[model samples]
Target chain A: DARVTQTPRDKVTEMGQEVTMRCQPILGHNTVFWYRQTMKQGLELLAYFRNRAPLDDSGMPKDRFSAEMPDATLATLKIQPSEPRDSAVYFCASGLVSTGGSGELFFGEGSRLTVL
Target chain B: AQSVTQLDSHVSVSEGTPVLLRCNYSSSYSPSLFWYVQHPNKGLQLLLKYTSAATLVKGINGFEAEFKKSETSFHLTKPSAHMSDAAEYFCVVSADGGATNKLIFGTGTLLAVQP
Candidate 1:
């Protein structure tokens, strides 16, 4: 069974520290999405990439948050000078959209970040 | 733009009892609605989805959802609830129809199943 893999299942950082989360999508999937989940905000889509090119990052804070797919297999989300409010579970999901496939996303376990 | 609303913030059901989770959606075009369940310390898992083809869609773990365009709702239901069914349920809508499968998730409903 293929699954999306995420690194740093748990992270604890002091405020103003830089935090980086990584994801390895299913081998053949071409689309990857980053979402942040919080008790107050539920789930928010931060960014997404198609074919290693970013399609949208409007939901992310441009000043501190960055998302990139350095290659098809690796997608990363980094937060510089992270704040306390940035504590949340970050999920990475992968999907295949090219073959007229169902618009279903397979999600990784998620990276839990706690900023103090 | 597309959005989803989960009517209940939390729902409690007894084991072997019926389960109903309400969800309503608004979209410019015909929307794709979905139900996702997340267990504690786990990622969200797709329960079922309703595209245009069928009004009633069946999903894993004996869960199903019906799309009602007249009411703009896609509510999830199950005949019997199990203890393992306790989780956070999210209602999601495809934000851009089928272009990129971008999804807008509702503030989830937490389901508690009592034994």
Candidate 2:
């Protein structure tokens, strides 16, 4: 079955370290989204790409967070000098163009990051 | 800005009892609502969605949600609960395709089913 795949299921690093998360979206999906889930904020959209071009990243902290799609199949989110508050489960989900009323999604297993 | 609210923090039910999870949304445009379930240590799974076609939307594993615009509620209900139904449930809302399609998720509700 087609599924969004994410790498490094778990990661633990010291404060001020850099953390990178990777996602491989479904083969035919046209949209990719990155979301972060934490206890305080619940789940929030961090970034999104339509047709491999980033459309929005306003929810992301520009000072330390960056998101990019080098290729159609791969999207990456990077954090430089991560802080303890940056620790959370990051999820990647893919969907098609929302032309019609129905638009479903396929999600990755998520990367759990911990900044100590 | 669109937002969602999941009313219950946690709910407990028996194996064969009916299940209900409450969700409400606020949006400027015609809203599209979605329900997602997350198992322990697993990613979120789409259960169902209300995208203006039908008020009653059916989803995988016998889960269903009804969209009520008058009440501003999109509550999920199952005829009977299974042990595997125990998970965290999220409510989502979006407006249009451009950037509003980027969903706003509610604080999830944890469902626990006992034997």
Best by DockQ: 1
Per-candidate DockQ vs. reference: 0.58, 0.47
Output per-candidate TM-scores for chain A, rounded to 2 decimals. Answer: 0.98, 0.96
lDDT of 2 by residue, A19-110 (tens): 99999999978889999988888888899998999998998999999999999989999999899999999999988874663555668999
Q: Native contact fraction of candidate 2?
A: 0.32
**Which residue pairs collide, candidate 2?**
none
TM-score of each: 0.96, 0.93
lDDT of 1 by residue, B48-113 (tens): 988798899999999999999999999999999999999999999887765686888899999999
lDDT of 1 by residue, A3-107 (tens): 999999999999999999999999998889999998888788999999999999999999999999999999999999899999999999998785445577889
> What does DockQ come to for candidate 1?
0.58
For residues B1-115, could you state the per-residue lDDT of candidate 2 as single tens digits?
Answer: 7778899999999999999999988877778789999999999999988888789999999999999899889999999999999999989886463333467778899999999
Candidate 2 regions exceeding 4 Å error are: A101-103, B97-100
Candidate 2 global Cα RMSD: 1.8
User: How far in Å is the alpha carbon of B45 misplaced in model 2?
Assistant: 0.3
